[model samples]
Target: MVEAQHKKELERQLWNIANTLRGNMSADEFRDYILGFIFYKYLSERMEQYADDLLKPDNLTYRQLTTDQQTILDDIKQESVDYLGYFLLPNELFEVLAEKGKNGEFILDDLGEVLRHIEQSTMGSASEDDFNGLFSDIDLTSNRLGKNPNERNQIISKVFEHLNEIQFLLDDTEIDVLGDAYEYLIGQFASGAGKKAGEFYTPPMVSKLLAKLVTAGKTRLRDVYDPTCGSGSLLLRVAKEVGVDNVGYFYGQEKNPSTYNLARMNMILHGVHYRSFDIQQDDTLERPAHSAKRMEAVVANPPFSANWSAAEQFKTDDRFSDYGKLAPSSKADFAFVQHMLSHLADDGTMAVVLPHGVLFRGAAEGHIRRYLLETKNWLDAVIGLPTNIFYGTSIPTCVLVFKKQRPQADNVLFIDASQHFTKASNQNYLQDDDVERIFNAYTARQNHDKYAYVASLNEIADNDYNLNIPRYVDTFEEEEQIDLNAVASQIQQLDKDMIDIDKTIADFCAELNIKAPF
Candidate 1:
C-alpha cells in the first residue's frame, strides 16, 4: 500500500509538471510539447544507460568521454545507433540542456540541431521510417511556446529539466511503472481534449477487455495488430496479456500524423524495440498499410460512427468486393469491419469495438452483415458495453469478434454487458470481474436466461441477419410493480398536509394584514 501511494504521488507530480508549463496553452497544444520533451528525456536516459553499460569494462562514464576519442566514440556511436535506433551525444543529453537553460546563459540552437541529428542518423537504416518526422510537432520557433526562439528554447529546456527530475522506473519491468504513468498522463490529457480524445487514446479499461477477448484461449501470439492503432495501447495490452516476449511483431496504422508519431514513441517507451513493431502514418482504409500480412491476434477500438470517402472506385477493392454494397460515407463502421476481416488470417481472431448502430442499422451495413454471416461465417460474438465507457462519447458501444474459422460454426454468442461497469466521474469502466465474466461467457458458451445466449444461423436469418443485441441477449430489465392503493393513500395524506400548511400561511398573512397569501 505504501508503494501504491508512492506511485500515485509520482503520477501526481508528473501531471503537475505537465500542467505547470502549459500556462495559457490549451491541453492539446501543450500536450504535444510536454509529451515531446518527456520523450526526449526518456531517450536521453536510455542513451545514458546504454553508454554506461558499454563503458563498464573501461571504468569510464558516457558524460566523461572526450570529443577527441574519435575511434572509440565512433565505434560506440555505430553500436548505439544500431541497438537503440538513435543516439545522443554527451553535450546533447537532455540533462545538459536543462541545466544550461536554468543557468540563463546558454542558447538552445545546438539542442534543436541535436534533435534533428537523431532523426538524420536513422536515415539509410531500417529505422529511417520510424524516426522520420517524429519530432515535427515540437517546433522551437512556434509562438505558442514563446514569441522568440530563445524564450521557446528556455521553456522547452525547462520542461526537460523538470521531466529529468522525475524517476521513470525503466529497469523495473515487474511493474511497468513508467508505462502506466505515461498512460495515466495520456488519459488525463485526453479528458480535457473533448471529442478529439477518440483520435489517439483508448480508455485503458476498454483496451483491456478487447485484449482479453482476442487473446482468450491463446497462451502465445505470433503477432498482434490494430488497424487504427491510436497510441498503440491496444497492441501493447495484447503483449501484456500473453507475455511480451511471446509476441513476434506489432503492426499498426494511424491516419493522423501526430497520433502516428505518438504510437511509435509509445511502443519504444514500453521497451518494444524498433525491430519488433511496424507503425505507419496513413489512412488504414485507403492505403491499408499491412495489407500483405496476416496477424495472429487483432484488436481495435476505432472511432465510432466515423466518416469515410466510400468512393465508388473501392467497389472493386478486394476488402469490400464481397459485401455487395459499399458502406455509406456517412458511417464507416462496416468499412472498418470489412477491412479488419480482410486482414484476419485463416486461423486468427479479431475483436473490434464499435457503436451499437452497426448491429441493427440497415442499407449498406445490413448488406455487409448478411455477406459476413451467410458467405464467410466469420461473425463470432457481440458483447455490449456499458454507456459512456469511452472518454467523449456517451452512447453505449459493442464489441464484435470475427474469426476466419470457429470451432462452433453454427452459433454466435451474444453477451449483454451494458449493465456491467463501475461508474466514474464522467465515464463507466469495466472492472476486472466484469471483464472476466464477459470472457467466461464467451468462452464457456454459456446460456444465461437473458444475460447471454447463442443464436443459430437460422435464428439470425429469421431476424433478417440484424445481429442486434436485444434480438439475442434480452437485457430489458422489467420495471418494478407499483401498489396503486398505497400510492392513492399517500397522495391523500399529502393533500391534508398541504391544506394545513395553506391555512397556517393564510392565518399568518391575516395577522400581518397582508391580504391573506394564496
Candidate 2:
C-alpha cells in the first residue's frame, strides 16, 4: 500500500509538472515537449546505469574515461547500442546538457545535434526503425520554445533540471513507477483536450471494460491487439486481467506519427521489449496494418463518427467484401468494426467501442448490421455505456462484442448501462459496482430487470435486424396514474376565483375611469 501511495503521489507530481510548463499552449502542443523531455530523462538514466555496470570491473568510470580512449569507448558504444537500442555519449547525456545550459552557455544547437545523433546511432542496427524519428517532435529551435536560442535553452534546461530531481526509481521495483506516472499524465491531458482527446486516447474506464470483456474466461492470452492503439494503454490493460507472459505478441497501428512514437515508448516503459510488440504508424482503416495476422483478443475505441474514403477500390478488399456495400463514406463506425472483425482469429474474441448510431442507423449501416446478425452471426453482445463517459464526446457509446466462435451461439446479450453511471462535475463515470454488474450480466448471459436482455436471432429478425438498445433492453419508464376527478375539482375552484377577481376589477375600474384588466 505504501508503494501504491508513492505511485499516486508521483503521478500527481508529474501532472503538476505538466501544468507548470503547459502555460497557454494547447494540450497537444505542450504534451510533445513534456513527454519528450521525460523520455530523454529515461534514456539518460538507463544509459548511466549501463555505463556504471560496464565500468565497475574495469576500475575506471565511464564519465572519467578520457576522450583519447577511442577504442574502449567505441566498444562500449557498440555494446550499449545493442542492449539499449540507442547510445548517448557521456557528454551528450540529458543532465550534462541541462548543466551546460544552466551554468555555462546556450545549448539548444548542441542539444539538437545530440538528439539527432541518438537517432543516427541506431542506423544499420535492428533497433533503427524504433529509434529513428523518436525525437522528431522535440524541436528545440521552434519558436514555441522561445524567441531566441538562449531563452529556449533556458526553459529546456529548467525542464531537464526539474525532471532530474525526480526519483524515477525505475529499478527500485518490478512495477513501472515512471510508466504509471506517464499514463496518469496522459489521462490529465486527455481530460482537457476535449474532442481532440479521442484521437489518441481511450478513457481508462472504457479500456477496462474492453479488456475485461475480451479476457473473460481466459487464463492467458496468446496475443492481444488494437488496430487503433492510442498510447497502447488499452492493449496493455489486457495484461492486468491475466498473467500476460503467454501473450506472444502485441499488434497495433496509429494514424498519427506522434501517437505512434508514444505507443512505442509506452510499450518500452511498461517493460515490453522492442521485439515483442509491432506498432506501426499509418491509417488503420485505409491501410489495415496487420493484414497478414489474426490476433487472439482484439480491442479498439476508434474515433466516433469519423469519416473515411470508403474508396471503390476497397470493394474488392476482403474486409468489407462480404458485406456487399461499404459502410457509407460519412460514418465509418462499422468500417472500423468490419476491419477489426476481419483480423479476429477463429478462436478469438473482439470488443470495440462504437457510437450508438451503429445500433439503429439506416441505409448502409442497417444493411451491415443486418448482415452481422443474420449472415455471419459474428456479434455476440452489445453493451450500452453512459453518456459523457468518453473523453470528449457527450453522445452515449456502446461496446459491441464479436467472436469467430461464441460460447452462447444462439443469442445476443444486450445491456442498457446508459443510466447506471455516477455523475461527476464534468463527466459521468462508471463506478466499480457499475462495471462489475455489467460484467456479471455479460458473463452470466442472464436476463435482468431494466438492465439486460438476451435476444434470439429470430427476435432480432422480427425487428428487421435493428439492434437498437430500446428495442431489446426496454428502458421505457411507465408514467404515474393521474387523478382526473381531483384535477377537475381544482380547475372548478380556479374558475370561481377568476370570476370573483373580475367582478372586483370591474368595480375598481369603474371608480378609476379605466377598463377592467383582463
Candidate 3:
C-alpha cells in the first residue's frame, strides 16, 4: 500500500509538471516536450550517480574535478563513454541547468548546447545508432513555445524549475520509481491524445495480456521483437515477465521519427543497456529493419487498417510473396501479420491485436485467413475483446495468436471475452481478473459454456474459413420462459376482486338512499 501511494504521488507530481508546460499547445505537442524533459532529467541523475560511484575511490567528487587535471579527466571521460555510451560534462548536467534557471540566469543557449553535445558524444561509437538524433523532436528555438525567444526561455525555465522539485528516487535499488513514473506520464498523455494515441502507445492492460500470452510456458526468451514498436512499452512489458537477464535482446521498428526517439529513451530509462536493444526508425513492411533476424516471441498492436504501398513489386517481396497476393493497399492488417510471420522463428509464437474485420472480411483478407489456416496451419487461438478499450477507436478488437510449431495443429481455440470488462468513465478496461481469465482459458484449450470453444480445422473449413468468435463460442443466453398459467390465474382473481368492490359500492349507495344508475 505504501508503494502504491508513492507511485501515485510520483505520477501526480509528474502530471502536474506536464500541465505547467502545456501552455497553449495541444496534448500531443506538449507531450513531446514534457516527456523529453523528464528523460533528460533521468539521464542526468543516472550520470551523476555513476560518476559518483567511480569517483568514490579517489576521494574526489565528480562535480569538484577541475578541467585543468587533464590526465584524470581524460581517463574518466574514456571510461564513461565506454560504459554509459555517452559523456556529460559537470556543467552540462540537469541539476546545473535547473539551478541556473532557478537563479534567474539565461539557460536556453546552454541547454541547447548540452543537448547537442549529448548526441555528439556518441559519434563513432558502437552506440551511435541508438543515440543518434534521439533529441531531434525537441526544437528549442521553435516559436510554438512562445511568441518570441525570451518568452520561450521563460516558459522552458518554469518547466525546469517545476521538475527540479520532484525527486525521481534514483538512489533506491529495489523500486523503479522513475521508470514507473515515466510510464504513468506516457499513459496520461495517451489518454488525452485521442486517435493519435494508437501511433505511440498501447493500453497497459492490453500490453500485459499480449505479453502473458506470448511468454506462456517459458521463463526466458531468446529475444523479443515488435515491428510497430510505438514507445517500446510492449517490448518492455515482455521483459518484465521474466528475470531481467533472461531476455537476450530487444528489437523493434517504428515509422515515426519522434516516436522512435521516445522508444529509445523508454528502453534506456528502463535500465536496458544501449548494446542490448536495436531500435530503428523506418517503414517495417517496405524496408524491414531486421529483415534477416528471426525472433522467438513477436508481439504488435499495429495501426488498424492502415494504408500502405501495395505496389505490384511487393507481390514479389519475401514477406508477402508466399501468400500469393499482397494485402490490399486500402487495408494493411494482413500485411503486418504476414511480415511478423516471416520474421517468426521456427519455434516462435506471435500475438497481434487487430480489428474484428480481419476475421470475417471477405476477398483478400478471407484469402489470407484461408492460407494461414489451410496451408500453413499456424492459426492457434482467437480471443475477442471488448470495444472502446483503446484510446482512439470504439470498435471491438480481437487478439490473434499464431505459433509456428503447434502441438495440436488440427484445432484452434476461440475465446469470447468481449463481455467481460469493467467500464471506465470514457473507455472499457480489462481488469487483472479479466486478463487472468483469458490466460487461463487460453492455457486450458478446452470448451467452456458461453465462454470458450475448441474448433477443429474441418469446422473452420465448413464455415468457409470465417474465424469470427461468435461462430465458435456460443454466448447466446436463452431467454427465460414466461409462466402464462400463473399470470392468467392472477388476472382472474384481480377481476373478481374488482367486481366485489363494485357490488359493495352499490350496497353502500342503496344504504345511503341513492338510486344506482346500473
Checking candidate 3 for backbone clashes, the offending pairs are none
lDDT of 1 by residue, 1-518 (tens): 76666668768888988987787788777888777777877888888889999999999999998899877788888898899998788888888877887778554587678889889988887788889998888777778878887777777767767777776644655246666777788889888888889998888878888898888888998899899998888899999898877889999999998889888888888888899999998998878888888888888888888889999889999989877899999899999998988878889989999999999999878888888999989999999989987877899899999998899999999999888889878777888999888988988997998789999999999999998888888767789999999999999999999999999999999889898746
User: Going through the candidates in order, what is the number of backbone clashes in each?
Assistant: 0, 0, 0
List runs of model 1 lying over 4 Å from the truth. 1-6, 169-175, 482-518
Query: What's model 3's overall lDDT?
Result: 0.90
Candidate that scores best on TM-score: 3
Q: What are the TM-scores, per candidate, against the unseen true structure?
A: 0.91, 0.90, 0.95
Q: What is the lDDT of residue 112 in candidate 1?
A: 77
Our tally of clashes for model 3 stands at: 0
Error of 1 at 472 (Å): 1.8
User: How much is 59 displaced in model 2, in angstroms?
Assistant: 4.3
